[model samples]
Target chain A: MKKYVKKAFIDTLPIMAGYIVLGIGFGVVLKSAGYGLGWALAMSVFIFAGSMQYAMVGLLTGGASFLTIAITTFLVNARHLFYGMSMIEKYKDAGARKPYLIFALSDETYSLVCNSDEGRDYYLLVSMFDQIYWIIGSVIGSLLGAIIPFNTEGIDFSLTALFIVVYTDQWLNTKNHVSAIIGIVASVVCLVLCGSDKFLIPAMISIMVLLFVMKKFCIKEEE
Target chain B: MNWYAVIAIAISALVTVSLRAVPFVAFRGNKQLPAFVDYLGKTLPYAIMGMLVIFCLKSTSFALTRGWAPQLIAGALVVVTYVWKKSTILSIVAGTACYMVLIQIVFR
Candidate 1:
């Protein structure tokens, strides 16, 4: 048990740094928007989806309707459907801890667990520790936001930078460019046609449809 | 918290959890996912990451006056550094620092 916990902690160290800064950004945004510590705690503990939480700040500030929030949340997290599918075989026999595992499957955690050869116990520990780090980071950030006077005009771009780095790594590692190209083209088209506020859902839907069509036609041609 | 805020959070939580739980519930009891679904599972990560990159840049305006030059330049640096060095931490930190400095000091 001790070894698993320690290994999980070590594996999660990179995410700790990323989450701390990202969580701080979220906390500061919430604080600046008139939300306090309790709100940050509640969202980080309950919602627990990092990117959606950031989007929630915008939704809360804009006073968006419940339907809009729900739709946006689904779209923002639609990628998780793929993550869960990939992990089905791995998590099927995780015993009683399976529910919590499913609940804590953030993008970073998914990447770590997907690539790791660790046991189920180690996977649980990594997931739990990652969430703890994020919770603590949010609390600290909210506290700091109350006292700090530093400029944070574009700090939220860290999330963007993180995604770009991940995209770059994935692009380099993979030989297949079909999915990558489809994703970029679909998203760019949606962004132009639907605008930033309404692009996400359309982009996601288009990517799935395009990938499906490409797989059928392109793979058939190859065979 | 306001009623609307509570509702939004609850709905978001529900949707997010349901999405994550779909595969687990749907594939229980020795059920096999279809080939197409398996293919999606394998290929979707790269595509989603690509989409997320574009999503992150959604705020950038291409017009000259809004000045997207800093983000563009910083993003290019991130790509080059990542491709050259292949370090996730170094690339992210370098890119983020570049953007921060550019937005705070250079662009401002």
Candidate 2:
């Protein structure tokens, strides 16, 4: 068990850095919005999702309806659906730990757990340690945000920067850019027509339709 | 936080977990996921990621003078930095820093 714990810790060192920093950003965002340590802890503990939690701050601040929040959460996290599909085989025998593993399967954890051939305990340890780093970082950030008096007027653009970097990574790694282009164009169109307040659902629906259409028409396009 | 916000947070966590658990519950063995589902698993991420990029930018105010510059320039910096460095952290920090300066100082 010690060996696996150490192995998980060593393997997830990079994720630790990333999660803690992003967690700090999230905490500051929460603090700026008048939430303090308790709220940050609740969010990082419960949601445990990076991007969606950032969006959640906006959703709550905007006073969006319950239905809107649910749909937006689904849309923001739609990628996890794909992540789970790939992990079904690896996590098959996770057994009692499976539920927490599934629940804690953040994007960073998925990237680590999916590629690993290490057994259940190692995966669980990695997930747990990653979450710990995240929670710790958020608490620190919340405390710091409360005490610091510096101007952080536009720090929320970290979310935007995150999305752009991920998008670019996917774009460079993928062969065909058709679906990516479609996603951008459809979303931009929807945002213009429907407005930012009402754009997400429409953007998601159109992206799915466009992807389906592309699949049907280009049945064997480059794999 | 109000009960409304608390419930909203619960819904977010619930929905997020449900998405992760879907494949496990549905495909409880070597049972093959449908071809379309498999296709989606392969293709949807890039598309959804692309959509998310645009989603983040949807609030860019077009009415303001130089409103587009911060988003545009910062987004370009992210693309360039990521391509150059291939580092997610570096790319985000660089882009975000550029954005902070553009909005807080340059275009303020």
Candidate 3:
């Protein structure tokens, strides 16, 4: 057990590096939205979804309906459904740790879990450690955001920058641009037609439609 | 409002956890995964990341948003820094710091 814990901690350090910073970003955004430390703690513990939590700040502040919140959360986390496909066999013997293992499978955690060949305990430890780092970072960020006395007028731009960094990396790694183009074109058209307030649902619908229609084209690249 | 926030968190958590469990609950015993699901798994991420980029940038004062010059400059700097360095933390920090400076003093 001690051995697995040590290995898990070492394996998850890289994720800790990113999650803490990103969690801090999320916490800061939540704080700026007038939420307190309890809100930050609750979100990190319960929601645990990184980018979705960031997006949630906007929704919460804008007074979005629960239906909107549900759809948005589902759409943003659709990737997890596929992630579950791969983990089915890996986690078949997870036993009681299985549920929490599935719940804690963030992108960073998944990146590590999929590669490691350890038993359930190792996976559980890694997942637990990752969440702990995230919680720590978020709470610290919330505190800092409340007390910091700086002109944070354009701090929100960091969110955009963070997404761009990930987008750029994805662009570089993937040979398929068709899906990427479809996503952008559909969202832009929806934004133009529906406006920012109502564009997300339309954009989501169009993305799904376009991707399904162009499925063969995307599949061809993979093969 | 507090109730709303708590409910939002609970719903988001529920939806996310359910998605994570779909395969475990629905499929078992050597079942072949559908081609469409596999394809979605492959393509949706790139697609969603594309959509997310637009969402994040929409109406931001940066990235040529309403001709916000400083924001556009900082946005470009972030891309360049990430492309060159491949360091996410560095790129975000650099771009954010540059935006603050531009808005605070340089473009002020």
Best by DockQ: 1
- For model 3 chain A, the run of ten residues with the poorest summed lDDT: A146-155
lDDT of each: 0.81, 0.79, 0.78
Candidate 3 per-residue lDDT over residues B22-106, each given as its tens digit: 8778765546557765556567666666666677666644334444776678889999999999887788788988987887787
The fraction of reference interface contacts (C-alpha pairs within 8 A across chains A and B) present in each candidate is 0.75, 0.76, 0.71
Model 1 agreement with the true structure over A80-151: per-residue lDDT tens digits: 887787787778779999999999999778766765557799889999999998998789888898554666
Interface RMSD of structure candidate 3 (Å): 4.2
TM-score, one value per model? 0.83, 0.73, 0.67
**Residue-wise C-alpha lDDT for candidate 2, range A1-223, written one tens digit per residue:** 6789878887666566567777888888988987788888998998898878889888888899999999988887876776787677677788899999999998667656655678899989988998999999799889887454666656667666766776787778656777778878888999899997678778877877887888754234545
Tell me model 3's lDDT, rounded to 2 decimals.
0.78
**What share of the reference contacts is kept in model 2?**
0.76
Q: Output the number of the lDDT-best candidate.
A: 1
What is the fnat of model 3 with respect to the true interface contacts? Answer: 0.71
- Model 3: how far residue B89 lies from native, Å: 4.2
Report the candidate with higher TM-score, 1 versus 3: 1
Give the distance in Å from residue A210's predicted Cα in candidate 1 to where it truly belongs.
1.4
Model 1 CA deviation exceeding 4 Å by range: A1-14, A32-34, A54-69, A111-122, A216-223, B1-8, B65-67
For all candidates, what are the clash counts? 0, 0, 0
Compare candidates 1 and 2 on DockQ and give the better one: 1
Residue ranges of candidate 2 with Cα displaced over 4 Å: A1-36, A49-97, A106-130, A141-145, A216-223, B1-12
Count steric clashes of candidate 3. 0
